[model samples]
Target: MFNEIEAIIGKAKKNKNYTQRGAVPSEEIADLESQLKIVLPKDYKYFIKHYGYCFWFGGVVSGLVGDNKRYEKLCCAIRKTKYYHDFYDHDSSYLSVPQQGLVIGKWAGGGYYFLFSQESERAGEVGLFLTETYGQEVSKFNSFTDYLSFLVTGTPDPEPVDVDYDRIMDIIED
Candidate 1:
């Protein structure tokens, strides 16, 4: 799984600067695999392996894009906890609860974004979340252990958006 995730990340980094219009780049399959540190389900691997650069937000915007249904199913299996619900309410901008087991949220500083895999845990097994960010920088998480450590102990990292609304409207009017 880790190997698959690494492959996805590698591809994303290679094309980080390339964008279409002004939207987030569709993450490369390699980059996604790298971040996940786990082999995606067979259906996902097949889609990504075959699709090449034409998958994800770059080509389609639906949750069904690239075998996300598998993850969605996993989310459905988990019971929503107070912590999860509260996180959703507090971060309304980034939280979407059309279903269960999946919790998406933007980090505080806006530098990073996350999609969590929610499920009931007994002791050592923890929920998994995929975090991605934009810009020229790349943040590192050596392993799932490292990623979880940051989630539990780190402060919120938010990116402040600085847009001149009035000026932008004037340009649009012209």
Candidate 2:
């Protein structure tokens, strides 16, 4: 297990009742991989296996799903918005490799943290893209755990009290 993931699990265990978004079956994961035509990072796979398909701290961090029709996945959100591509496609410096990873964690001001399938030193290694900022390029987050830690430190705001996780996937880019 990734040490960061262990820390994330530990922190969540210490902070709350540990409610999972829900379990994603192995077959669905495999189907997602097949559809994406890329191997998912191992840490992410472990995360899905243990943490399930929902974001942590309510809806702060997004999770990848095996099937979009059945559940919300990172790609599902990305596919809905061409904003990411429209804003960053011409900037080679920004690494517009939407095909290379999943948008697992979103940030304020249209920023997002993506897990790279390529151009990363390790599986589950992530980088941030600030869509609203100029020349922001990428902010490295060593691992998914690190991204979770940032969110944890910022606050443990449980999934928005009024937001329905089931229906929230449609508006991730909004």
Candidate 3:
């Protein structure tokens, strides 16, 4: 799965900002899970285990690696999750992120992409949340693989449907 993503990214003309670090050790992944108290999705774990952090196409896919000054401005999965936790606290009305949600990616334009952990039925599924809206999900995929595929390629797993505020609220309320 990750190989396919690598191939796609390899085709792109990398700019100076492109950074794709190497694989992380299993112990490091375990430690991160323990520290964050979150179980990353299997596909994401596989990607990080073999491909570390990635900054491509002007977006970022978080990972456990990257502690250098170069990545100071970058937010790993844990940091991004904590950042949103504060955002949710300060603006609960505009942030509808699930308690089980962990941000896995972010677009340069401020759109956050997150996945619900194993605790929720939404596990592995990727949901897009925009702060500009009432934290309503702008788009969602059946899985992280699908989301990554769409992010790397122009194709979406299934065409993205704009999730309305009412529908999103209904899901969250349940």
Candidate 4:
């Protein structure tokens, strides 16, 4: 899966901003789960385990191993810092995140791509959330893998029909 993404990204002539890094150590994954107090989805685990610090438009705006400076890591690095653009407050972000929801990725604008970790029915599904205009948080795809596929390629990883990105996009544009 990682290789496939890299291939698509490689094909793009405008991929200079996207940076895909090496895999995260298994021990680090375990430690992150322990610290975050949440069980990561299997696909998500596989993704970070294979790729780290990966994303487009300057950095990985989503996932655990995203760019540290522009994106927040779920561990101690972001808890005390106030540089990233997370919707939830940083001091209590950890406690609120896995419980309320988990933000896996983000769009170039202000919307966030998330998963509802506390709700089993919504488990593994990823969504987009834009709080600025009081927009609804809507599902974007079926899983983390789906989101990544869309990111590297112009195609949907799982392709969702229920998502209302267009509605939110309209609101965002206003």
Candidate 5:
């Protein structure tokens, strides 16, 4: 998974639209998990740890570092999650805000925000929250990697790459 993500990052790096904000330290990621009160999916954690936040393809993947206050302040997952939670609570007509979910990122100036589920059965999976429908009839992804691939290349599953779980575990364990 890391290798495939690396390839995606490499491709994005060459594009003018890609702008890496910064990489987050492990501590900050942990702090974010604490703030969100959920253990984030492993793949999402890896992205945050190694790449931090970024603006690429057509959206911003936020992190602890808010480089541009005006933009990042609104895009921040923590804030978005909290706000949406309260929002949906007040208005039940709209699809309920994802339960135990975090707003990972968005596309097209917040036209859509990706919600990462922390629920036991759906952990690591992401669902699109189209602002227009309030997330009804939303698209879904198997994992963070798939969601990211869609954001980067307009596909859920990109070119296949061999994955050695042992090696990946070793790298991530450190």
Candidate 6:
């Protein structure tokens, strides 16, 4: 999946004449993996290794200046997946791929959001997603790799609330 995302980003970068935006290069990703002490999911690693920073979401940091086809395809694909059904309804908007491991979504407050998991704790995932999607509005993470490190090892980071987990478990128990 990551490799495919990378190819798509490369094509978009070339065709659209925009500099790649808000992406962490592979080296940085590697360093992040090392710091966090976790192996990234194969699909996630594939994306960073091949595409550098571009992911399913593209228009955030780089400006709305890349290949629309690539962006559209990502949105379309995600919309069609079971993952979408599980986390989000069909009505949500595709946000941005803020970092290697996170995808952001915006929907009516009742709908759940999508998040691609890494080995790190939930706080790290939230932090990475927040920084990447919001950019300067949020503080920069200590390092791109630090985000990955948080995902894999789940170490040395604050715990994040698992809203989905809590809700689902509540439903099941009820």
Which residue pairs show backbone clashes in model 5? Answer: none
The residue pairs that clash in candidate 3, if any, are: none
Alpha carbon lDDT at 56, candidate 5: 53
lDDT score, candidate 3 = 0.70
Per-residue lDDT of 82-122 in model 1, one digit per residue for the tens?
23444445642333322222222223343322223222121
Tens digit per residue, CA lDDT, model 3, 42-142: 88788778767677646677776556556634747777877776776586466556777578777556667888776678888888877656666777888
Please tell me which model should have the higher TM-score, number 4 or number 6.
4
Question: All candidates' lDDT scores?
Answer: 0.31, 0.56, 0.70, 0.53, 0.65, 0.36
Q: For all candidates, what are the clash counts?
A: 24, 1, 0, 0, 0, 9
Candidate 3 ranges beyond 4 A from true positions: 12-17, 157-174
TM-score of each: 0.21, 0.61, 0.79, 0.62, 0.76, 0.30
Superior candidate under TM-score, 1 versus 4: 4
Worst 10 residues of 2 by lDDT: 155-164
Q: How well is each residue in 47-87 modelled by candidate 2, as lDDT tens digits?
A: 77666544433444555443445445343433422346565
Name the regions of candidate 6 deviating beyond 4 angstroms.
1-3, 14-17, 21-27, 55-174
- Worst lDDT run of 10 residues, candidate 6, spans 57-66
Candidate 6 at 34: error in angstroms? 2.8
| Model 6 C-alpha RMSD to native | 14.3
Between which residue pairs do clashes occur in model 2?
A: 58-159
Q: Whole-model lDDT, candidate 6?
A: 0.36
lDDT of 4 by residue, 3-40 (tens): 66556545442666555555777887777666655566
- TM-score, ranked from best to worst: 3, 5, 4, 2, 6, 1
